[model samples]
Target chain A: MDRAVFFISDHTGITAEALGRSLLSQFPDFRFERTTLPFVDTEVKLRAACQRIQASQRDSGQAPLVFSSLANAGLRTLLMASGAVVFDVFEGHIERLETALGLQSAQAVGRAHGFHAQGRERIEALKFALDTDDGLRADAYGAADIILVGVSRSGKTPACLYLSLQYGVAAANYPLAEEELERVELPRTLRAWRDKLFGLTLAPERLHLLREERRPGSRYAALPQCRREIQAAAALFQTAGIPCLDTSNMSVEEIATTVLHRSALKRLRW
Target chain B: MDRAVFFISDHTGITAEALGRSLLSQFPDFRFERTTLPFVDTEVKLRAACQRIQASQRDSGQAPLVFSSLANAGLRTLLMASGAVVFDVFEGHIERLETALGLQSAQAVGRAHGFHAQGRERIEALKFALDTDDGLRADAYGAADIILVGVSRSGKTPACLYLSLQYGVAAANYPLAEEELERVELPRTLRAWRDKLFGLTLAPERLHLLREERRPGSRYAALPQCRREIQAAAALFQTAGIPCLDTSNMSVEEIATTVLHRSALKRLRW
Candidate 1:
């Protein structure tokens, strides 16, 4: 039987989902039926959520788990009395935070994902990322916070976009073509910004599989071609003293974070 | 004086940052010096983080707040003894979850952002988003989970990319060109996928300002042009009975979540 879990929030519910999912990942043996209820800031919505939670509890004969990041104390109180196992995500920590800072919490709803000046910066970063994607505008590399260098399908585009959208980092990616890989030195266009460069490599088998999905039975997706490109790319990274990550078994989030860490680049927005 | 806050995790530190930022947003009056320490899985790295926290406490004469999601119990215990205000993100909730499920946690490290089968799905979704971005491939609409329709610079691309990267939802976006907006009807290609259409609109002034940044003094960036396009787009959405959201004051996360909520689409990955 799968347990029912709800992630409730007054805003976009992204934080609640993230926190709940991270905790639940610890218990991988159990299956969970998960739902996210965002923008639940009003009394009317609270009542509706309570009914759904209670019904789930009755249907399963088990108390449904509720993970909430409701900044409103009154709504959180109402939720706690709804016959569910409610975990107040902000409850235990806010008091400690207040004590530590010698101030009271504002308890405002929708503050986490609301519009702000930084939002515009994030948009600009996203534009920069798209405009510079796939080595389109290498001249714009002067303005980039970090530039990702990798062979095609080495997980560069997704990592660049994730870094930009999530942290407002101006990230651009350049794909090393076969001609560039055949040479022993870094591409001339990237030499000026070597300090801002980070490399991504993947296992040859994985690279071949990824390329095969896009271009089946083509020379580009051949195992030998992938192996040669990867070997050459690795040698280039070693020669250039560029820090690299093997993204064979990593997600976009992991690759982005590793790039930020290795390059010592600060996220423009949090 | 600004207080120091650390988001520590054995993995990417993204969950800790999200949870910490949400809690910190409650105290907007206070300025925070934030740092993220990711992949702190070893005792040596844990010791280094403790030193940074302790240094901040000593310098500011205030206990630095540490938001940690370290899955290893021993590392967490050591973090607690570091003489800072440590908020163990998973402690109070994990015990309750254990009690409810009658199972002990796996206590694994890097489980949240590690590679899994769903990671591949997310990558494929990202590729779909880019391939169909800005009406590049209308033929691909049949395969998308959702298609976002909006005028240029009305916040479609970022929303589509975020939806694809974060939730593994194959979101394709179509920019409503001047000809299509003037016609005051759905684009001919989009008629086949009306059920998957979601609309995004922005304030005319905001739209004009965004366009002006790209092409100064152009007719496309004029306020009258923006107003005309917006009014036509709104009427088209209304006549087509498609749900619309004004994205003038919303972030990309908010836009993506609202689209998922209004469309009743399930996130392919958590």
Candidate 2:
């Protein structure tokens, strides 16, 4: 079944989107497309998302499933007629909490539970890696919950580490070597668990700018090298059917969330 | 001088507020208060905050030192007349980054650095502890840059561990014992490092709920005992002159940020 998710949140879109990703991480192999509309109180934003979902169905020529985690109840009627399966986290969690607590869920108190599922393990793992100074924490193929493969200075290491620090994901990043790029093949270890492998590539100019920070005058930071490696990496990723994201202008939050949301193995724990 | 810190940010206020607490940790003798205004956009919210600062000054009969890290340029004019010393992180790091890069300040890109700088030793200690599974990370008292102490569920342990992981700060935490609470005095090891020791306390009810999750039908989770221990802990903290936070309502992000913001010894570095 085709599936698409939409988040209509009261605050910023980040909360709903983050919640969606964590939940998807629990349910792997669900072909899902998801998007979020912030400040959904307005009809215009709501209608645009609805139209976009409709367009996706039209383009694919397949009936799609829709799940909404909305802060607003007003959209319930509006979305019911959209001909997509709808599962709402807001209601699901609220019902569960109320059942357990044997009382009505207060908005403030309930919101607290949303943040309770701690990334404690993830945070601890990061500490273990950083504390030991054992460079293995940096190796992507072995320890990472998600391995980020990309050309040098494509924001692989920091982004993966940030994911580890912030979310408790054991994010190990492997840089694409020139030899690997020449072969246009994924890393040997990466090929074993192709499902967990994700690629991050950026614009050649951006790569040069980021690299110039570490080594100012070197062929390693040259634009030609960046362009070549990125092109080769993209080709390998496409060949392996591993999803790749172009993180050229995206913020760290955007890049991490996009990868989490679009990944085939995302299971929703939040 | 009496000091109180306020964090204003375009991002989540929880993060700014956490960072503020971290900065405060640096000056152990400073009597400081802290608060945050997250997702602040309206004129009324700003005005209310200014009034609160004024009221605080009037009550204390002293000019309050205020640390504000505002992301928005709009608040500058409004706060110019306030009777508090405001340090803005948004503007503070620009020159540092430029000097490091040996580039003209104007030519330096603003959003470049995001990594931990201090406490590498502690991270290593924690890593060594976790790998050996010896729980010796607990015994890393002398090596710790800072030590955390509180009751079982007061968030001391995780916070210290987070510091160890993120910045490699040697962090040791000791849970207060029943006898220690009865004595209503700082534990021996904590008293020895009075200047470096920080305390964490949470609302009794919240502590009870948290304890109940880990263990149900235990004396620790009982409301009466929870209240008693928390009160005793607070009294001990007051006598020791160690600043403590009531972490019941706050998220982990909030707690960690406040610790970092207050810790004078650390700063954001790559």
Candidate 3:
């Protein structure tokens, strides 16, 4: 028999229930039952939740676990019946956060992580603009509060795109060409926006990981060129003092947030 | 001094690091410093990571709070020298899973969530076929391997979209119309694909929470309608014996996973 799981919560039970239900997808054999107590915000609700868990177990003829993000104190106790295990995602994280931050647990219940990703809106808009592939201009740098400059696989586009989406920052990025590197000078348009510019560089191995996704096994994926280009880019960012952040170890989200936080720019939110 | 929160991991640092980075974006005032020990397989790597943390403390003024997820044996000693409070995402999860499963700790050192969402390929292909104003299809109940039938604002679209993006599943959903509820008989097309079809229902409150995103205030947005629609639709699902999943407190991911798991269908890659 497939083991059953139940998801219960304090309010609007849909979302709280969903958080636990989603975990079931990973374990295909497990079955799920969800109950959302939206009307009652009292101890009675918790008792009701516990009763539902008991009923599900009795009906299913299996020990179905309950995963809840309960808000009310009564609800938490009601969910504590011993027929099956309970994994409370909300309370677990709330307790962890309290310990981590040296504070009391959160007053409310439910998953805390349902926010829009930072910089996503701005990233999407900028991606829309850059897809036009227009050349750099005087006003382009001015319109863009921050500019990302780097070699092809050094993680410019995705990082900039993430920034725009999560923080709503109008980020623009231009690739550093071989000639531009040879000249070793910022573009005339970017010279004025130097303080706002950020550079991304990566180790050869990471650049290779990225390039493999694009062209597979081409000269563009060559390690030597990757090393040389990364070195040149790092030198340029260092000399230019452009607040370069290496994308070698950072994920797409991490790289984007690092740039935004470091720049001390107002977070762009919708 | 602004708080310095660090997210570090031993394996697949990219993913673990990305999740942590997303969490940090919630706080704008904090000075976030992100560093990753991408492949902390050997003791040498562990020692080096420890040294870096020490160097960071001595170099920076603030005591960096480390959020680490390490699966290896030697990291505790290395991190002990850093003299900062730490919270590991996987430490508790690992302990619980081990005890529950009666298995030794896998010590899986990364955020490795496998792909288990159902129905993306058909949906993406439908995106190619999309030319409707009422959403995806007039005959959606006919063609879907799993048709998500729900009342409006019941999280059908996002669940379908997530199925399309994450698991490569071809998910289609049809809104429960007033006329359809009155009939409550399965639509002719739905009867043909009854085995493949599933119902998505949510608590009235959850339905309201979801609808709040699109239209805030109106008689259409009142609780009575929400309660009436949910009860009617759920009763309809019950009479039909169509497997129904409630989506109130759930995320898009949870809904999709629940359907895929319950249906025992292969999940598509998003």
Candidate 4:
């Protein structure tokens, strides 16, 4: 039987969902029907959420699991009365934080995703990522905090976007073209920015599958071509003393975090 | 004095950082010095993190606050002994989840950001977003889950990127060009997909500043021009019966979440 899970929050529900999903991933035995209720600050919305939880409980014949980060005390109290097993994400920690800091929490709503200077930085970084995507403007590499280089379809674009969006990092990517792959040395345009370059490489089989999805039955998607490109990229990374990550088993989040860790680049906080 | 805050995890520390940041936002009185230690699954790394935390405590004259989602029991125990005020993100919740579902957790590490089907979906969505960005490929609108229509620099590209990266939503964006803004009606190309269109508008002052950052001293950056284009876009949204959001005060996260909520689009779970 599939268990019902609800992520409730006063704002965008992103934090709640992220933490809740992490917890749920540990429990692989059960299938979950998940729902996210964001912007649930007001009493009216709280009541609506209560009704939804009640419905889920009635239908499933079990109290649904509710993970919430409601900052408002009243709405949180009301939610607890909804006959669901609620896990307040901030309950145990907020009081402890207050005690540790010797201060009171403002308990404000929707401060997590508010527009601020960090937001502007993220927008600018995103623009930089798009502008320099696929090595379109190598001249802009001077301003990039980090540049990702890899064979085509080797997970450069998504990693760059994740770094920009999540941490406000100015990340640009250059896709190694066929001509560049045929050579053993770093591309001339990338040599000057070698300090900022991070390489992404994947298994030849995985690369073949990825390229095949884009263009099946083509020489570009052939396994031999994928193997040759991967070999050349790895050799280039070794010769240039550039750090490279194998991205076959890693998601963009993992890849981006690994890059930051290996490169010792601090994630800029907004 | 700023308190040190550590986000520790066995995988990417994104979940820990997100939830910790949200909790800390409530206590706006004190400044926090934050560090993230991800992929800390080994005993060596755990010892290193403890050293960092102990160093922070010694430097700050107070124990640091550690927020962790370490899945391994031994490492988690080691983390608890680090002498910091540890808030294990899954400590209290995982047991409850096991009892609730009558199953034990897999207790795996790095499950949150593993390369999976959803990761592939997200990469595909990102490619679609880039391919169709700024009305480059209007014909590709047929494949988009949602099409964002807005004036230039009104938060279209970032929102589309967020929707794709976070939710695997194939979002495409079209900038309302100067000629299209002059008529006050939906563009002829957009007329076909009006149902999937979501409009984004911002305050004229904000729009003017944004445009000025891109192209200084241009007529497009003038306040009057900004106001005129905004008015025309607003009138066109009304004429086309499309829902619109004022993005002056919202982040891309907020904008993407609201679009999902308003459009009744379910965030795809892998």
Model 2 over residues B46-157: C-alpha lDDT tens digits?
6777787788778877555444444344564466467655544333333332242234332211122121122234335444333322123444555556666788878765
What are the per-model DockQ values?
0.66, 0.02, 0.08, 0.65
For TM-score, candidate 2 versus 4, the one ahead is 4
Best by TM-score: 1
What are the clashing pairs of model 4?
none
Query: What TM value does model 1 have?
Result: 0.98
Misplaced by over 4 Å in model 2 are: A1-103, A106-111, A117-119, A124-144, A165-168, B1-251, B260-270
Model 2 achieves a DockQ score of 0.02
Question: Would you list the clashing residue pairs of candidate 1?
Answer: none
Q: In model 4, which runs have C-alpha deviations exceeding 4 angstroms?
A: A113-115, B113-115
**Each candidate's iRMS in angstroms?**
2.1, 18.4, 8.5, 2.0
Model 2, span A130-171: residue lDDT tens:
432322434434555677778776766445544555555666
Candidate fnat values, all: 0.66, 0.02, 0.01, 0.67
Error of 2 at B189 (Å): 20
After superposition, candidate 1 runs with Cα above 4 Å error: A113-115, B113-115
The candidate, 2 or 3, that scores higher on lDDT is 3
By lDDT, the better pick of 1 and 2 is: 1
**Residue B83's C-alpha lDDT in candidate 4?**
96
- lDDT for each residue of candidate 4 in A14-67, tens digit (9 for 90 to 100): 888888888877776677898999999889999999999999999889999999
Score residue A106 of candidate 1 by CA lDDT: 88
lDDT of 3: 0.58
Task: Give the per-residue lDDT of model 1 (tens digit) for A34-87.
Answer: 988899999999999999999999899999999998998899999999989888
Which rank order by DockQ, best down to worst?
1, 4, 3, 2
